[model samples]
Target: MSQSDHDCLFCAIVTGERRGHIVSADDAAVAFLDSRPLFKGHVLVVPVRHVETLTDLPHTRVGSFFGRVQDITSAVERGLQAAGTFVAMNNRVSQSVPHLHVHVVPRQRKDGLRGFFWPRTSYGSDAEADDYAARVRDAL
Candidate 1:
């Protein structure tokens, strides 16, 4: 797919100019583990095309992109054995990265991820980090 550089992280990721903890990838989209996860199994699904926001893309692309997102969500739900999944897309305001990507956060009851109220805490040690990574990798 064609892309423009100009402040687009997803484009870099798609082109292999940047690194991310990718889970699944197809011709149209890629799914990766979130660096700063809302939950243990949080993942991000992004289209190959570079669109600043959801509204910026064409309807066909949007539909296809979301379809991919749904597929990833299902994988995350089953793989992680999650009680549920929270799928979200950010526009201009919530757009941390300019690219149009969807978040698929695996949720469990009493996991303390309810409603995005809890603050994220960094891993205490390398062992803890590795353990978390292993868990997520297993789910993928």
Candidate 2:
């Protein structure tokens, strides 16, 4: 997308027009803790310029966008002490927000996440969410 969508939630967060548990940001992408996380330290990485879906992302931005996703995946694992991570993206159908974003969830063996059936949990409080955001941000 050439410009930010005024009504897009991710765009609002990316532009600092809305509050988000922001973890990291740069020219190419932004990373933040998912309000409803599959696990603590779950992060959503999105292109700085709002693109509704992966197919809409410019070919030139694909590598850098995903490189940031890769970095967030590692950060989630290191910061949360997860065994690994569940990294995924959905197109228009299951996409919660219209903007393109990749979910990088901290995972451990037997954490009970199965397939696409994600069971979400909250940070319980703003301070808790801030703590999680801080840990990942420090790792980044």
Candidate 3:
């Protein structure tokens, strides 16, 4: 095992060496409720292997890892009867854990979840956000 794997909490959870409230598991990934949840139904989806960042995750495993996240995102919304869901990942900054975890946060309209950035303001326009999206998409 690599040094990171030896020191990794998520890896221990994935291997069953550490106890986690595992909600789902498969060959490619694992899904579990967050120890500290954004909401009751909040879940953290992670790759079965120890990958510290999205960019570090193997491209071959991307589909499987995110497929599980997508499944859990839907389940979080449906099970909690949330109006919507906020799915996000932090590469390194603001990441409480070292593992690559995708947070599936349940959301409702006007749930007071605003200001998600540094004195953050909402996008000036959908077009502006779309321009950012287009840049990212073009890169991909």
Which parts of model 3 have CA positions greater than 4 angstroms off? 121-140
* Per-candidate count of clashing residue pairs (backbone under 3 Å): 0, 0, 0
Model 3 poorest 10 in a row by lDDT: 113-122
Candidate 2 residue pairs that clash: none
Which residue window of length 10 is worst by lDDT in model 1?
1-10
Estimate, for each residue in 36-87, the C-alpha lDDT of model 3 and write its tens digit: 9877778889898888999999889999889998889888888889998989
Ranking by lDDT: 2, 3, 1
For model 2, how does the per-residue alpha-carbon lDDT over 85-114 read when each residue is reduced to its tens digit? 989999998999999999999898988998
Clashing pairs in 3: none
Off by over 4 Å in 1: 1-6, 116-140
Local lDDT at 57 for model 3: 94
Candidate 1 lands at a TM-score of: 0.75
Query: What tens digits encode model 1's per-residue C-alpha lDDT throughout 1-140?
Result: 35355557777777777898888877778888888998888999988877777777888777777788888889999999998998888798878988878899998898775575447779899999999999999998
Cα displacement (angstroms), candidate 2, residue 59, comes to 0.6
Predictions in order: lDDT = 0.83, 0.90, 0.88
